[model samples]
Target: MADKRDYYEILELGKNASEDEIKKAYRKLARQYHPDVNKAADAETKFKEVKEAYDVLSDSGKRATYDQYGHVDPNQGFGGGGAGDFSGGFGDIFDMFFGGGGGRRDPNAPQRGNDLQYTMTIEFKEAIFGKETEITIPRTESCDTCHGSGAKPGTKPETCSVCKGSGQQEVVQNTPFGRMVNRRACTNCSGSGRIIKDKCGTCHGAGKVKRQRKINVRIPAGVDEGAQIRLSGEGEAGQRGGPAGDLYIVIRVKSHEFFEREGDDIYCEVPLTFAQAALGDEIEIPTLTEKVKLKIPAGTQTGTYFRLKGKGVPRLRGYGQGDQHVKVTVVTPTNLTEDQKELLRQFAGVAGESTSEHHESIFEKMKRAFRGD
Candidate 1:
């Protein structure tokens, strides 16, 4: 007892420190020395010591005992609560940590199940529209062999003599706080207030079994990569007779060979022959649904843009659809024959080679505007 470090020294606070000050010091030290956050060799031991210090100092009754006697007895309820301070009302904290294990939880309560997530990869076109998918997930279900009671078939579970089927036990201790009542879950019956003398051969003793279940998921339109679709009540079965949780389907859209997307808009590059660009041509272009004829204007140059309204992805949340923007690239004829070269040379000699006099490029337009032409 004498070899133990003073609780105040462990928290780096003085004996005259207030309750709030002690709480702040303890929280800071707890966060700094917590085993999960700090990987030092002594972190876990330091965390336990810090928790012990906070447990005593946070309680007015235990702190008084420690101040006078220099040590608070563990068996006398010194470090029972710091994190477990249920002074306001026991209902909130009691339900959280113990899941209402203290003489409260009904044997047939409907506890909520766990939430699950599954990643799915889909085609680019399917994301632009939508797709119906079925996935399989592993879940925990109540054992059919024992009917969730963990007892063998044809034999009922015996009543627990420890808690007398009430699932609770009263613990009375005398400390500086006077006589205190601390009720806990019965250990022998595991707070169920029932003893399974005969276990199910299939399940051994566990009341649940792991099962693979198939679930249907609906992927909405315009759902991008990393989008999540939630299916309610599709997760693991809850403990006892609880309700099922939600299942989240995370989307992974595959890359498209022809198109790229940004927010609501779609962009694509299409190649056009120089003659088809110069003289207007009705070209076949691919849309989400079908190939359509796109009319290219006469004298259309490279980098010309065309818009197909409502031809891209459908809106995921709003009223209308997005437009597809196509950039035209006029491909020059490659590997020209001698006759083709001679024809081009003769045509260039007669024609005005300047783009401003012919079909003006974007750069030429910009220069003309800048020079006030």
Candidate 2:
């Protein structure tokens, strides 16, 4: 007993650790060192040590006794009562680690159907305005011929003789601590609780059939890319009179050639000729719905952004529309006649000392305008 390590040290917990903390630490260490999961030679030995520590620390009475007397032989009644006082602890620990040993589940109970997801790609404009379309999907549904009974036309299924409709059986084992009872699905009826003598030809005793179903989905207005629309009770059919699951339509919007969207706002770049940018002009800009005229202010520099209020996409959740932002890019002429070049040279000579100075002046003005100075 003196050679045994302290329970708190085995769990890597302080003496003042709470019960929840102790359980969490034990579960972590147990999973890490469990022989089935960990292949190391010492894993099984470590797992046993962790289990022993947990068995002593997890119980309030055992913990108090161990805290006062340290490790003592169970045959000597640790403190007062015999080892038989701790009967159901190991069963609970087994259920906690292995799962499905807690209690029996009803095989005939209604279970919600599995949810389904479908990805659909739509045009960019369709995402902003929303659209309704029908799509076909393959899914399993209750057998129409047998009405989900898995039996022949006139015959019904019989209760499983092995499990007696409970759908599970108990396996008793004698462990080192005591006898442990574990519950498992019955092998006779394969946990369905019923045996079909004459199976339905259509579903082959499965009680379900696969079919292509067409369903109409309504995409809400202003739904963006990667958005999802859910249709209630439109997925795969449920079993044993259960409610059907939901169908989720995942939206994938195709990229637009002219516009980019951010949240509800729209953004697009428009090219302006040097003359049009210098002298100002009203040019037609294309939006999601129609073309609108945007006035270019004289001396509008490249990369300058202009906001058009209430011209972007409509808000999906609330009232009012987002503003459209237009970025200006001044386009320099590549092809110029000798006479035109001479004329531009004469204009530049009269305008400033160098073109660099003019660019500096324009850049300064752009900075001031951005700052609202």
The prediction achieving the highest lDDT against the true structure is 2
lDDT of 2 by residue, 141-211 (tens): 99999998889889989999999997877677665444545566799988888999999999998888999
* RMSD values, in order shown: 8.3, 5.3
Per-residue CA lDDT of model 1 for 1-373, tens digit only, reads: 5677889999999999999999889768876776556799998567667867887888898888888877656455564333333231323223433344433665445578889898899999889989888888898877889877777998878888988886777776553323445567788887887888899887776777889998887888899989998888888767667777888888999999999998778899999886798788999888777787899998997778999998888889997889988998876567889997677656655675543346764345545653658
* Window of ten residues with lowest summed lDDT in model 2: 79-88
Cα-based TM-score, every candidate: 0.66, 0.81
RMSD of candidate 1 to true structure, Å: 8.3
Among all windows of 10 consecutive residues in model 1, the one with the lowest summed lDDT is 84-93
Instruction: Score residue 255 of candidate 2 by CA lDDT.
Output: 90
List ranges where model 1 is wrong by over 4 Å: 1-10, 13-19, 30-111, 158-194, 351-373
The lDDT for every candidate, in the order shown, is 0.76, 0.81
Candidate closest to the true structure, highest TM-score? 2
Mark the regions of model 2 whose C-alpha exceeds 4 Å error after superposition.
1-101, 353-373
Clashing pairs in 2: none
